[model samples]
Each structure stands twice: as structure tokens, then as C-alpha cells.
Target: MGRMVPAKAAFAGLCSSLVGIGLARFAYTPLIPVLIGAAWFSPGQAAYLGAANLAGYLAGALLTQRIAARVPVRPVLRGMMLLVGVAFLACAIRLPFAWFFAWRFAAGFAGGVIMILAAPAVLASTPAALRGRVGGFIFTGVGLGVAASGTLVPLLLEAGIAATWCVLGALSLVLTALCWRSWPDAGVAPATRRAPPARSSLAARAVVLEYGLNAVGVVPHMVFLVDFVARGLGRGIEAGAGFWVLYGFAAIAGPMATGWVGDRAGFGTALRLGFVVQAAAVILPILTTGTLPLAVSCIVMGAFTPGIVPLVLGRLHEFAAGDPAQQRALWGAATASFALFQAAVAYGLSFLFAQTGGAYAPLFAVAAAALALALAVDVVARAIGARQVRTRRSVAA
Candidate 1:
């Protein structure tokens, strides 16, 4: 029972993330052109709808911890999963733009709530030594959803868009059922005490800020990558989707690979390295859009997309110092920060894409710049932390 508990909790987290982010958020990427082509919406409307999800994600992130405080964590997790499933089914009908937007927003809201709450709920039961690996497994659901959507969306398109939405909705509900009994009922109870002061420490703030900036770094690829390959670069939708598939495959490997690195070299070190590599990848399109360069760019960017989540979580766990309540609070704040930036950037970039007349290079350039700035902030924060440790050690001596 002891061993089974952790395993089941981890599996439950995985299913929640797969539904919340994987299908709810990422599955829409490949469908942009399909929505436009089917005359369901114009290109600009499709882009704005994508932004709507991020807006709802922001709302969910801000509210999750507060909701968890009043309600049990397990029911909240289950409800959010079911909400995402229903959102997909509701979106299947070809309705007014407002109707689709509302459903997309609902799905995004559920994703944000799940993303904020699920990992911490599971990790509360995970052993300290295994948290990194367990977290990696939990987030791998996002990549799995991505890979599944990338591969399945095109095939399902043959049947029609409504059918594709139905299939995704059904899959989400099935996953929810499989994990229904697996959640840890007592793992993430409401906090009755105040968090430690360390929650506001320099390193903790830096991690949250860096996470927010990462949201900026990812917006271009998340929002525009498929459209860029399809319409901006003059590749057909099939070729664009091929790149998206490549992205999904790379994403599948990202979290586990980074988690292994975090366990060995330390989460902080892995995070800095990720920023540098991601910056390089984000800028590749600006320098050249050759097939090889684009492929390399997509592979690297995709891997780090969901890959950074576990790294950030592990780093924050270290700061929380084994206090599950503090960890949840810290993580909630970090997630809200991330969602806020992501929502703002998504809307801003969508506007920029329109202003620039569908130009893609500038978008990538902006993303790369955000990553570079994140790296700089992280470096300064680490330096200050190390110096503070040294000062404290000297004083004790």
C-alpha cells in the first residue's frame, strides 16, 4: 500500500496534466488552419481564440490556490479534469464565435487549475529523493498529449473537425475515469498555518520571475509555430503539421531528460542551461528558415516547452524545505505569474503578427530576447544567493 500510493498519485497527476494542458491547450495548435479553412472562423479570429485560452488560464492560475483552500484538493482536481472534457465536447458544434470562445476559455481555465494544483498534490506524497523523477513523469503527460494530438489530429481530420473534437473529448473522459480512484485524498489539504518567510526569499522570487519570462519565450512557438510553417513560410498544412509532429516527439523526451539532469547536476543548473539552449533555438528562424534549421529549432523548442515545468517545480521544492503547504503556495504564485505573462504575450504577439502582416521572424526574435533576459535574471539571482550563503557561513565561523 505504501508503494502503491505514490505510484497511483503520480499516475493521477499525469492524467490531469494530459487532459488539462495536453489536449485542452496544445491540441488546438494543429487545428488553426482547419478552423480557418472550414470557414468556422477567420485567421485573425482563430488567433484571438487561442489568446482567449491563455486569458482563462491566467484566471485559473490566480484562483486555484484560493479555491483549494476552501475546497478539498482531490475533488477540485477531478472537477477540473471533467470540465476540460466537457469543454472539448461543447466546442465540437459549429456555433457562434462567442460560444467557441467561451468553451476554449473554460478548457484553458481547467488547464491552468490542473497545472497549478496537480503536481504539488502528487509530490506531497512523493519521497524527496524521487520528486524530480516523479515530477518528470507527471509532466510527461503534456508531451504525450502533444504527440497524440499531432499524430491523431490529421488522421481524425479525414473524418471531419467535429469528429476530431468528439474523439478528444472522449479520450479526456476515459483518462479521467482511469485515474478516478488514484488521487491522494489527504495529500494536499487546506493550510491552517502561515508559510515560512523563505517563501519570499530572493531565490524563490527569481524562480517565479524566470518562470514568467519563460512564458514570454514560449508564446511565439506555442501560438504561431504551426501557422508560421504553414502560411508564413509557404509550406502546406501537411508540411507544417509534420513539423508539429516533430515538436511533439521532442517534447516527449524533454521532461525526463531534464529531470535526470536536475537530479544529477541540480535543478538550478539545469534551468540556466535550458534558458541558454532555448534562446538559441528561438532565434534560429530569424537567422535562417532552411529545413534543417527549422527542424532543429522545433525539436529543441518543443523539448523545453513542457520540459521546464518540472525543473521549476523541483527548484521551488528546495526552497520550500519540505513544507507542503508552503510549496503549494509558492507554486501557485509562480503559476499565476507564468499565466499572466503568457496571456499578455499571447495577445500582444497576436496583435503584432497582425500589424506586421503575418511576419514570423520578428516574433521569434522577440521570444529569443525574452529568453536571454530570463537567463540574465537567473544568473544574478544565483550569484546573490551564493554570496549570502558564504556570508552566513563566515559569520557562524
Candidate 2:
């Protein structure tokens, strides 16, 4: 579209994601192996800790939405960003499991608030036509954060986990400060005060289903990829870190490419392509242990996992049109649904992983199947959209 979204505003949105999602959420993936190696927790306990974050995220999504109904979003967003940094600092205290869980949970909660608000804020500032590209650029912060974690965390691991936690927290505050002034002060529009429709249409329902399925499909990699690569593949921690870095790089690329495709072809088309590739990528490590396949798998998985979110959110944004209130509600519901599925899978798969004697193949199989199902649902949604367009044209004629 016209010049894409503004560079300064888009970069601020990216930094919000960097602190909220990249540092708060995805940073845990590479840290999973370290937590195991340090004996702060066993694999199963560590999984629970991770699950706790998702649980908090789900709760935060619901709570944030409820609060937004009554209060302004910008203040909440700023408060959440501060909380994210504080949560990270609290994690460095090295308390009991319950305490650690609470801190992580709080971080996830803050992260949830940031995720729900940041996209809407950024999209609201930009032209409707440029939302897709702006969304892509915003998510690149996640990839950058992931890449930073992959690269920086390992180096920081040399300093010990406590130190690492403090450092990460400090970095989060710095990023938060940088983006502090960027959020819009305009409160929720008066029109947004009226509640959204009681029932969603079939297309909206299908979109929610697709979003949930994608969440399930991502679990194997998010929680277990480094573990699978290091322990399962017998590659050791460094190789796993290398794969993580590859994934981070790919994550950055995937969203940008998807944005370009969405701008030209359509968001639906970009999503379909991403799902197919991601499904294969999820299953690739199990298919062959060769270096090339594994690397390709890591890169593809990295790119599409976060890449899908912008596409999904873009479509949902379109559904809400100019209604800020509806957009907030939609984002909250979509994110909560995604977080619920992810939390369920995290807990369930941990138990399964323990029962299966740590074999990762089955998890990959499940992830691939979820992605396949998501693709199928997306296809149906696209068909319905096309049919609706045709009907409208006919009526107009």
C-alpha cells in the first residue's frame, strides 16, 4: 500500500512485542534445556512451570478484555509492560517452586495484556490497507527476541541462571522504556462501548477453530524442540542452540514474506501456504535425522509459528472493521482460545512425554495432524468467503 505503515510507529510496536512476547514468552524455549541442565527442576516440573505461564496468559486475556470494557487500554498496556519487566526481575529471586510459578504466571499475564493491546494500537494508527505489513513488522520483534535468546542466553548461561534472569529483566525494561511514548492515548471509542453481537458467524467460528488448531500444532516445537534436538537427536546443547538460532532467523523472514503474499494474493492464501509448510516442518525431524532436513525443519517451524498469528489477527481485524471495541473483544477471545489450547497441550504432552519414555516422534505426529486440520478448516473458510462475495456481487447486479 502507500509507503506501508510508518517506520517509527511500527518499530515501537515491534519493541512492545520484543519485551512482551519475545522476552516474556518465547525466551523460555531455549531456557527449557538449561533449566533441566541446572537441576532447578526436572523435565516434568519444568513443563509445568511453562504451563503455568500459559495458564496465566489465558486468565490475563480474559481479565484484560473485561477491564477494557470499562477502562482505557493504553494505561493498561503501559502497566502491563512494566509488569513484564518486574516479573522477570522477580524470577531471579530463586524462591520455591510455587513462588517461581507465580512470577512466571505474572509475566505471562502481563505478556497477554501486551499481546492483546499492542496489535490493536498499532493497527489503529496505520491505514487499513497497510495493516498486514505493519503486523508482520511488529512480529519481527519476536523473531529478534528469539534470535537474541538463542544467541545471548547461551552466553549468559555461563553466568548462571539467576544472573541470566536479571539480565533479561533489565533488557526488557530498556525496551519498554524505548517504546513507552509510542502507544496512542486515545481511549476506546464511544461506539465501542456497545457490546458486540451475542453470536459469531460461521466464518468467525471457523477462524477461531483454525487459531486453536494452530496453537496445538506449535506445542512440540515451543516446549520441546531444544530438548528433542539436544537429548533426542544426541546433538548436545550447542547444536540445539544452533538450531534455535536458525529458527529465530527463519521466524523473522516468514512473517515478512507472508505479509508480502497477503498484500498481493490474500491473507487466507498466505495462511494456507504457511500451514502446509509448517506441518511438514513439524514432522521433519522424525522423518529424517539428517542435518539438512533438521535445519530446514527448524527454519520452517520458526517462521510459520509466529507468522500465522499476524495473518489470523489481520483477518480478525477485518472482521471487526472500524469498531475498536469489537476488535478488542475479538483479539481477547482469539488469544484466550489460542492460549487455552496451548496450555492444555503443554500439560497433556508433558504427561505423555513422561509416559512415552521421552520419545518425541508422537508429539511431532500430533503437531503435524493439528496443522493439517487447521489447513482443512482454513480451506473451508476461504470457500465460504468466496461464495459470500459472489452472492453480494449478484445482489448488487
Candidate 3:
């Protein structure tokens, strides 16, 4: 029972993501078709709203870093979850584009706050040996969110978009209430204060660039995979929903499996494996047409999507030479950079789809290529680190 306590705390941290990310940020993907069907906005307008949320996320990521030491994370996390609930309810109001954008942006911002705070706090509270497992558990919330939204939104859409939005908001409120006391206190871990690495460090550059590219990798699945399955492939909405549910369940496995691998093989090696798997997953749908193939593609994509970040974060800390401060700074920078890249890609890919008359093949291809590039960058960074070590050894000798 005592052994189960930390895992329980991790589950409480999971609510931060279940509400902030699962409901607030990711629910939009499955709900997109309903929004268009209900004529709440045109497809193009919806694209902009998606971009707006990413923009808000970027702002929030940056702000979390700046206020890390000054602000208590638990209160901020609770407040952010509450704000996410409010934003979801606000979406139900028949508002003009500007107001809708504001609400979506607010939700995105709250998601960012939860992402930045929840897992780090959990890691701090947990013993070192359990850190990897706890992280895997916490991030599984992303998949849970994806699964919940995929399953629930379709049923709720029967009652119209407004009701769907309100029910989701209410669900978030209930979750927030249930997990209210689970998170660790503010001082549990170094949520904010980290030593900064030198600007010219090879590992620093590699991790930052890898973080940016990681955002690109997720864009295809997160933003367009559902539409691709349902509309592009003529699979229908039910098929799309099934794929999403598969993605969620598979994603739950991704972090747990990969976290164990990272513990055994090392974070850097695990991350490289993740990059290869994710890139292949992105390209699988493009290469095949059968139901089974597409379903496998969805599962592969889903598993890797939420799992990779914890690995990257682990790698960042590993390369930070045991400096807690540097680890924190790099984590913040990576988070902010990821948000910025995602925001840009959201708009750019949307524009590309519009220009090409909604052709999705090119988008997935681009995302796969971007992941390949990230992997290459990590390889070079590792090479640089090895060279630096050799030079230091020669001097000492």
C-alpha cells in the first residue's frame, strides 16, 4: 500500500492534464467535424482558431518559466484547470470570431500551464527510482483525453455543438473537483529555478532544436488525422472515432513501455528509437489503404505522440550535467519553443491544405521528414559531446 502511494499521487497529477489538455486542448480535434457540420465556422475559420490556441499556449509556456519561482505551482495549476473549464463553457455561447478565439486561446493557455507544471511537480515529489514510471503515468492523460473526447464528443454532438461544449466543460469541472487535493505542494520540486547552460553548448542546441521539430511531428496526427480518416479516406465518422480511440489506448502504452526502455537503454537511445517509430507511423497511412493498416497507423501515432515528450525531457536533464537549474531552463525553453513551432505549423499547414484544395498527403510527408531531421540533429549533437569529452581527456592526460 505504501508503494502504491506515489503512483496514486501521479494519478492525481494526471487530472491536471485530463482537464487542461484532454478536455481543453485536444477535444477540439474530434469536435472539429461537428463544429463545421453545425456551421459554427467555416473550415478556414476553424484553422485560425486552432492556431490561436497554439499562440496562447506559447505565451503561457513562456510565462510559466518566468513566474516559476515567484508563483506557487499548485494554486496556479488549480486556477488554470478552473479557467479551462470556464473557457469550455464560454465556447457554448454564440460569440463572434473574436470572442471564440479568446476562449479557445484561454483554454490553450491553461493547457500549457498544466503541461509545464504537473509532471515536474510529480517528479519532484516522487523518489528517483519511480520518476520514470510516474512521468509515464502522468502523460498518459494526453491519451486519455484523446480517447474521452473521441468517444464522448460524437455522442454529445447529437445534442448540437453548444451542448457538446457545455457537457465537456461540466465534465472538466467534475474531474477538477475529484482530483482537487492530489497534487504536491509548491515546494516539492524545483518547478522553476534552474541553472542555465552556456549558450554555445552542443547539447543545449540539440535539445532545443529537437523540441521544435517534435512539435512539427505531432501536427499531422493531432490536427488532421481524424479528418483524413473520416473524410479523405471515405471511412466515415465512426471509423475516424474508432481510430482515435485506438490511438488513445495505444498512447497509454507508449509512455509506460518507452519509459521502461529509457530507464534500461538510456534516454538518448530511447529518444532515437522513438523518433524512428514516430516517423514511420506518420508515413504508414500514406503508404497503405486497408482498414487494418490505417488502424495500425493510428495506434502507432497515438502511442508515440504523448510518450516522446517525457523522453526528450529526460534527455534534457541527463545532458544538463546534474544541474537542476539548467534542467529547468532547458525544459522551459523546450516547452516554449515547442509551442511556438506548433503555432506556426498549425497556420502554415492549414494554408497549405487550403492552397492545394485540402490535399493531406503532403502534410504527413512533411511531418515525417521533419522528424527525420530531428533525429539527425540529435546524432550530430551526440557526436559533438563525444568529441568534447575526448578533448578534455587529452588535456588531462
Best by lDDT: 1
Candidate 2 per-residue C-alpha lDDT over 1-397 given as tens digits, one digit per residue, 9 for 90 to 100: 2564556667777888888888888777667778988888889778777878887888888887677766676667777888888988888887788988998899888888878888887787667667778888888888888788778887888998888888999998888788777765443332236547623356666777888889998888877887888899888978887787888888887767677677667776777877898898888878898999988888788887678878987777777766777777787788888988888887788889989999899999999999999899888877887898899999999
Model 3, global lDDT: 0.78
Tens digits of lDDT, candidate 1, 1-397:
1363467888898899999999898889778879999999999899878888988888898888678778778888899999998999998988899999999999999998899889988887677667777888889999998898788887888999999999999999999999999988655676666666774399899999999999899888776887899888899878887898899988888887888788778898999999999999999999998999999999988888889999999999999988877888789889999988887887788789889988888888889999999999999998988898899999999
- Model 3 lDDT at residue 86: 90
- Number of the predicted model whose TM-score against the real structure is largest: 1
lDDT of 2: 0.80
| lDDT ranking, high to low | 1, 2, 3
Clashing pairs in 2: none
RMSD of each: 2.2, 2.7, 2.6
- Please give me the total number of clashing residue pairs in predicted model 1: 0
- What are the runs in model 2 whose C-alpha is more than 4 Å off? 1-4, 32-45, 185-192, 198-200, 384-397
Question: Which lDDT values do the candidates have, in the order given?
Answer: 0.87, 0.80, 0.78
What's the CA error at residue 23 for candidate 1, in Å? 0.4
Clashes of each: 0, 0, 3
Which consecutive 10 residues in model 1 have the weakest lDDT in total? 1-10
CA RMSD (A), model 3: 2.6
